[model samples]
Target: MEASAAKAPSTLAKASRERRDIVSGEVMDEARLIRFVVGPEGQVVPDLARKLPGRGLWVAADRVAVETAAKKGLFARAAKAKVQASPGLADQVEMLLRRRLLSALGLARKAGDITSGFEKVSSAIQSGKAAWLIEARDGAADGRRKIMAMARKQQSAPRVFGLFTAEELGLALGGENVIHTAFLAGRAAERWAEDARRLEGFSPLLPEDWREEPIEAKREP
Candidate 1:
C-alpha cells in the first residue's frame, strides 16, 4: 500500500495557533487611529497625519464630545498633566477645518472638477452635475440668494457651503477673485464635504440666516 501522507505534529498545530493569536491583536486598526489632537480645552484639531509634537489627545468630532471633554478635563487626563487650554479652541479648530475644505476645493479646481463664474455654476446646477454649491461668505446677499435658488432647482439639490471669503475663493480657484463656485462629485468633492461638515460642527456662527445674520450686516430701510 502507498504510504499514507504524514500527519502534522500536535505541537506544530499548537504553535501555529499560538502564532495566530499573537498576530491578531498586533495589527493596528486604521479606523481606530486618531486623526486629531485635542487642545487643553478639548477641541479636536486635525493633526494632519498626527505628526505634531507633544503628547496627543483625541475626542470625537462632535459638539457634545468636545464640550464634554473640555468640561471634564478629559484632555488633561489624557495628557497625564495640567495643560493650558486655549479659550475658543473650538473656533480655532473650525477655522482650520474650513481651510482644509477650501484646500480640497482648490485641488478640485486644479483637477478640472470644479468651475466658477455665475453662469458656469448655474449651468452645472441646471445639468444636475454639481455636487456642492460654494459661495463666498462675504458675497452679496442678493447674489447668494439667486445662486442658492438655482441650486435648489437642480434635480439633486447639492449641498450649499459658505465659509470662506471672496479673496480666499479667488486664491483657491486661481482667478482675479471668485465669489461663487461649484464642485462636481469626485475624490476632491468627497474630501471637501467631509472637512466642511467638521468645520460646520465647530463653527461659532450658528446656522440661521446666512445673509441676514452677518456680524457686520447693516440694517436696511
Candidate 2:
C-alpha cells in the first residue's frame, strides 16, 4: 500500500514497545498500532494517546486494517461487547489525526519553533535548525528539490514530510499558499511529528514506497 512517511520524533522512539493487532493478530510497537476506546455510549473511538477510558483495543495503523476491524466485526470481538462502529471509521480517525497534528503545528508556531515561506525555510535549512521539514505535496517540484537539497546538507538531517497539500498546509499554518514550512528542533516539533505519523496511516496521503511500520527510535541517528 502507498503510505506516507510516518517517522517518529527523537523524544518518543528511544525504545521499542509492542502491542497486539486485534485484526492481524500480530504484535508490534505503538507506532504501528492505532488504539481504540469504547465510548461511554458504546461507540468506538480512536485514542492515539491510549489514555481514554474503557478497555483499549488495538489495530494495525494501516487504513485497510482499520476498515477490516470495522467491517469484520473485529472491534466487537475485541471489545467483547456489542459496540457501535462507524462505517466511516477510517475517515473519522484521519480527521481526528489531522486535527491533532494541525493543533500541534499551532502550538509549535506559538512556541516560535516554526518557520514558513520558501525563503525562510531555506534560511532555516542553511542554519541547520530545522529538525522537521514539511513540503506541500502539490507544490512545485523545483522548489521542493531546492529545500530538500538544503535539508540534506544539515549536520543533523531533518525528517521531511510531504503528506499535505498546499491548501491544507495553509489552513493549518494560517497562511495562503503555504507550500513549505519547517519545524525547528524542540518538543513541539516532536509532538507534531507523532500526530502526523498517526494521521498518515489512516489517510490516503502516503507515497507508494510507504511501509507498515512503527515510527520509533526517536534517539537514533
Candidate 3:
C-alpha cells in the first residue's frame, strides 16, 4: 500500500507533461494543456508532438480556453511580439491532432507493431505482448466487449483507447473494417500511446475513461 501510494505522482509525472496556461495563469498537465508555437509568419500553431522548435505557448485543452486566448490577444502578450492567432485556431488544432494520430497509427502498422482484426488482436493480448488496445468508435459492441474481457484477465492489463472511427482506422492502416487494433509491445507502441493520449486530451469525443477491464463496450455516447 505504501509503495502504491508513493508511485501515483511519479506515474502521472511520467505519463503527462506540465505547462502554464497563458490565458488563465494556471498550471496544467498535458492532459489539460494544448501546446502551441509561433510559425515563421507569426501564426500560432498547435505543437501536439511538443517537438516544434520555439518558445511554447500553452492553454487549457478546452475549446473555450483556445477561443479566449486567440480572441483576447493573450498570445501576443505572452510572446512579447505581434503574433497572429487564427480565429479558427481551435478547429485547426483538432484537425492537426487528428491527422497526427492517424499518421502515428500508420507508422505503427508499417513498423509491424500494430495488428488489426479481432482474432489477431486477441491473440496479441492473450500472449501478454500488447501494450495498448484501440477500438474503433463504430465497431460492433460484442467485439469490443470480448477484447476488453481478455485484457482484464491479464495480470497486468494493457491500456485501452477508442478515439477514431472505423473509416479512419481503415484509411490509416490500409485495411477494411478495422474494428480493433492492438499495439504490440515495442517502441512504436510506446510512441503511439503518447500521441493517442494527447489526442484524447484535446477531443472530448474520445473514450478517455476506458481501461483494460471486464467492462461494457466503451465508445462515445
Candidate 4:
C-alpha cells in the first residue's frame, strides 16, 4: 500500500506537465486541448483519440480556438509542412466529439451501467445510485421538472446531460423514445462521464432553453 501510494504522486506530477496550444501558444492539460495530425493527403484531421501516427498539433478545445487555428494556417505552421485545414474543421471536431460521447453512452448501456424510463431513473436518483441523469432534449418539461426536483432533494444529486434528442438517445442506447436515462454509479458510468465532459467543450450538455433550478452535484476532482 505504501509503494502504491508513492507511485500516485509521481503519476500525477507527470500529468501536470501541460501541452502547448499551437493557436494560442498557451499551455494546458491535454484533456482541454484537441490534437490534430496531417493525413496522407496533407489534410488536417482531428486526432480525438490522440493515437494517430504523426507529429501532433494541438489547439484549445474551444470552438473559437479551433476556428482561429484553421483560419490562420496554424496547423501548417506547427507541422512545418504544407497542410490543408478545411473551413469546417471546427464543425468536424464537434461532430467527432459528439459521436464519441454517444458511443460511450452506448457502451455503458450494453454494460448494464444505465437505466431508462421515468420510474427507473427516478428510483436511481432517489436511491443515490445514479452518477448522471440524461434527459432527452425533446422530453416533456413537466417530467424533467419532477426529476430535477427529486434530484435536488438528494444529498448528492447526479450530474445532468440533456443535449441529445429523443431519437438520438434512442438510436445510441438501442431503445425507442429513450427520453430519460440514469447512469448507475460504476466504472462504466465514470468512463461515459469523462466522454460527456469532453463533448461539453464543443456543445452544451443541456438544452439552450432549459430553465429550472440547478441541482448541485459533486464533480470529479
Best by lDDT: 4
Q: Where does candidate 3 stray beyond 4 Å?
A: 1-20, 24-33, 51-54, 60-64, 205-221
Model 3, C-alpha of 138: deviation from truth (Å) = 1.3
Residue-level lDDT of model 2, residues 17-131, one tens digit each, is 6678999899777876789999988889999777887788999877899999999999999989999889899888887777777777766787799899999988887887887
Give the per-residue lDDT of model 4 (tens digit) for 129-148: 99889999999999999998
TM-scores, one per candidate: 0.68, 0.76, 0.74, 0.88
Q: Give, for candidate 2, the lowest lDDT window spanning 10 residues.
A: 212-221
What ranges in model 1 sit over 4 Å off? 1-34, 38-56, 204-207, 211-221
lDDT of 1 by residue, 88-158 (tens): 55555566666777677777887999999899998888988887888787888898888787776665677
CA lDDT of each candidate?
Answer: 0.63, 0.77, 0.80, 0.86
What's the best-to-worst order under lDDT? 4, 3, 2, 1
Query: How does residue 198 of candidate 4 score in lDDT?
Result: 63
Residue-wise C-alpha lDDT for candidate 3, range 1-221, written one tens digit per residue:
99999999898877567778998998766656788999999999888777899999998776788999999999999999999999999888778878987898898898888998889999998999988888898777777888888898887677776778999999999998789998888878766665555555456534655443423234321
Worst window of 10 by summed lDDT in candidate 3: 212-221
Clashing pairs in 1: none
lDDT value, residue 59 of candidate 2: 90
Candidate 4 weakest ten by summed lDDT: 212-221
